[model samples]
Target: MTGVTLAKAVKKYGDVQVIHDVDLSIRDGEFCVFVGPSGCGKSTLLRMIAGLEETSSGQIHIGDRDVTGLDAADRGVAMVFQSYALYPHMTVEENMGFGLKMNGHPKAAIKAKVDEASRILKLDDYLKRKPKALSGGQRQRVAIGRAIVRGPEVFLFDEPLSNLDAELRVDMRVEIARLHKEIGATMIYVTHDQVEAMTLADKIVVLRAGRVEQVGSPMDLYADPDNRFVAGFIGSPSMNFLKGQVAGGVIVVPALENRRVRTSVVLPKEGATVLVGIRPQHLTVEAGDSSLILELRERLGGVSYDYLRSSTGEKIIVETRGDEALPEGTAVTLDFDDTKAYFFDGQSEQRLR
Candidate 1:
């Protein structure tokens, strides 16, 4: 297995540029994920690395050799796409071996590789089954098995689990994680789901508008985000942002009943408004309070998410344990540890720290 490096990489079609000057490094045997919303150029960047799309300028190096000008087939990388793309008439065993056979490898060599991939993916029993007979998760495994048979230096996955159902998606996420541990290959995965990025990646590249926002380990990005976009994007339910105005190094928030938030982070000029971010996990509500109303409650088995709406229609969500239900119109007061809050510049939207 080998690493991948992109230096000053830029992609342009005519005069319209979708990918900007991006530089990234993926170490050997590392599982890196490119994550962002739709049209963020995550897929286009992956395609460029795979040699499926042309690089208008800059360089891409796989391990020690520069593969910028190489063809897709000559890049020593195998890709598993969103669709299975399996041959309907062929059996699982035949499909897994087809790539090697097309390259004119000996039948014996192809069979040996297929057997190994089957064992690794636990598809030894379904080798003779066709795509139509396999479950969605099984078909995805076969798609992955096809890539594993090639023994590429790097493996690229383009949202391979998006097509699966919720349960199947979870199951395949585990399977893909296990596959990486067993093979220890350099793998790059793309997905908009932060849950997948948090659970599967050793490193994550957060992108937006064709620009790389930040790159770091899952916990590093989660616990300490550089900007408002990353702090909101890395966590589930997201961090809440409340408007406030600075007064003598203190932030006064109207939503928290003019609560004073004192943080060590440098404050802007007095009376300058800023943003205070707090995760739902850190927020709690006091029943029988003024202003804030319990708008809705979602009972999700072990935990419940309570949605609160202020008199001004500002929304806040609180995650609490147990399945207790709160009345829709019940009055409440928002409470949180002031030290746990994050301060951001209102105009630039950057972290104040």
Candidate 2:
């Protein structure tokens, strides 16, 4: 149960560099997740920490040891990949114990470790089953069980639940969270799924194009993002952005029928362009002076979302918990507190405040 640290880590392939100087720290027994879009270098960074990819520059330390130059097997870290990669011919029990057996652990020790892992993963009933006979979730659990039997100091998961169906993904998410609590081991999970990152991570590292965008708890990143990219990426339904510019110490959004919205962030200059961001949940729809037309409505049991299009044609999503559904094609006003709004530089896409 130890932490991991990366100091100015860099990775390159011949002339091209994908992972920039990344400096990160994961606390002991913490569930840290690396999350971003495809080719964002999250997987590369995870591989670097697992010693699968060499660090072209900088250092990586697991616990107290500098493991930058260590081989995958010597780094005291176990990786569960996107694929289960199970041996087709072996039973669940055999697959789980294979790593330890290959390491020359005694038969008794291997069986004991495998049994413990199976118990943790709730795979005792399927121990005798081969890969082909088990469901997708079961196979994944077996893959995780294999990792657990090795008893590595840190566990690295690279999109381990991507292959599962929606229902199984949710089930496995709970299972993995439970596993973390039961084992209390430092874990680093990589995924492009923001929902998974938001639900599973104790801390999240948001990466973009070989760079660290932001790092914080899920809500922290959601409520307060450092840049436009992060503000838009971290939340479900995404934050709605309206084009605007500063005028008379307020931001003027043309999409809202030239309505002026006040912001606490200092304006760059009068008429300087900026982006106004508001979360869908923060928006309230009511009869008012604004000229927003409800274009569509999505009712999802306990909640509903109203999709609106402004006079300027900018689309907005408004989340509501009301039982009554708003009729589409109805003209309505969208209201939100100015303080709840986020301002970003139009050019840099950085948060103004």
Candidate 3:
């Protein structure tokens, strides 16, 4: 098995600790993504796995071997960096075969490997072209081909699509997905874009301040979050948080004009402050007695988002797929199912279950 495992991993710079003690296991041939905000140490952790960063104190196992102290070249991992670090003077074929040639591989073997990688990446047509002559997406594919030719047990991608334009990013995303399916190598990708993480990963490890917040499949984190942060961070447009309090065996949301809402879980003690979470997709705009003022509407072809402000100045986003457009400055009532609502303790910021 070419799985990767980290046991009590910790990274520190002098007295300040960056990567907290983390324990994780990535199965063989699984696509795992490390996702978080900048400075959360996702890239640092990826580099640690690739042997590019030193592990302060922990055991890092790649397959059956403990590779904690091994150099990058001995780790059997190929990293595709964000920047296309190609030799501008060399052709794509030469750049892809350079590593093997330096390692004293036979000319015939190197040629065969390069040819296979070029075919997989659809770079056969541009193999003779220099980096300066190819487009950004094509250059990135060449970089990936370089890694493919190495035939490492694991592949590390560090925001490889971030440098490309939006359209090119989408195109490269599909290409990478296809390549993963074709090669079936253990892949660990790092990205700040949740959409990329959601679309590409078989399992997602959400990090915050160098600590693991949650680790699960994308839909697991989306539908069954363990805490408030996971609930808010995993979804697009984020989850709306409204002020509420537990009173008389029910939760009452002040932002919704003290409407009594029911919960599937046991309520906290009376007068305890709590937060009511509703996803934008779950909320519907309808005529009612609620005091939500529509501030703006964003139309995106088949769907739309209505930005509303509550009486308490809390901003709320409501997603509607209907073709009818709601005008601005319209006072509308927001409706949502009670079962779809999430409750969190305001003091601890943890989900109230």
Candidate 4:
């Protein structure tokens, strides 16, 4: 296993900066995931780490070695691409041993490595099958096994599960989690899926438009977000943003009861026009006040209900247990639990209180 460090790493396509001096250190054997929307430069950053793409400036270190000028083959890092990149004509065993063969490893050694990888991935029965003969999940496993046979210090996965079906994706995700525990290799995964990042990562690095937005554990980013963008982005259905300001020690929302959405958090300053973010799960829907109108309800088993806040025309999804159904346009009370609410400064977008 190897720890990776990127110091002031910058990537630019001519003048367009794709990565803005990112400085990050990933610990040895840690499963770190880089997560963001499309065009966020996540893949570019991963390629840089793999040495498939060069950094515009700064340094990259793997374990104790400086590898900024190294080629992909010499970086001691194996990358599994989103496309799988398997040779269609080659059998699973051949594909897994291809890297070793190209590097001039002995046939017997290659066979041993392939056999070991096949056992780990449970692909022993499918060794002679070509890429076309295997299922999507199996093909992905071959791709992963290929990386495994290389015995790299660090592993890079660029949305390796994106091509699989929903059920297959879940299966592969569990498989990958198990693989990490079994191998204990340093892994850097890039994905746009929050569920993937949340479930797989030991630490998640959230990126946006060439900048690192936040880096933390899933619960840290979910429970205590650094900014409004992070607070909204990390959670499913997202947190609710209400237009409010501090008035006489109370967060005053004109739409709620008593013309105020009160909170216990002490305002850092007065006359601050801030956005009050309350997660959908944090809002209590009750038959108390009149302003809270339930626009829609999506009941998905015993987990929760997704209730759209009708009062503000904002899509608010509430998580509640049981088969409780609130009809569309049902007027109800919305209570923002003080302990769960987060205040954000309007201009800076920084979290307040």
Listed per model in order, the count of residue pairs whose N, CA or C atoms clash below 3 Å is 0, 0, 0, 0
Score residue 106 of candidate 2 by CA lDDT: 100
RMSD of 3: 1.1
How high a TM-score does candidate 1 get?
Answer: 0.98
lDDT computed for candidate 3: 0.93
TM-score against truth, every candidate = 0.98, 0.96, 0.98, 0.95
| Candidate 4, 1-353: lDDT as tens digits | 88999999999889888899899999999999999889999999999999999899999999999999999888999999889899998999999999899989999999999999998899999999999999999999999999999999999999999999999999999999999999999999999998899999999999999899999999999998988878888878778877777777877765465456566655656767778888777777766647667766776677666565545555556777776666777777776667677888878888875
Give the Cα-based TM-score of candidate 3 against the true structure: 0.98
Clashing pairs in 4: none
- For model 1, where is the 10-residue window of minimal lDDT? 319-328
- Candidate 4, residue 253: lDDT: 69
Instruction: Name model 4 segments beyond 4 Å from true.
Output: 258-269, 287-289
Candidate 2 per-residue lDDT over residues 198-229, each given as its tens digit: 99999999999999999999999999999999
RMSD of each: 1.0, 1.4, 1.1, 1.7
Candidate 1, residues 119-168: lDDT per residue as tens digits? 99999999999999999999999999999999999999999999999999
lDDT scores in order: 0.93, 0.93, 0.93, 0.87
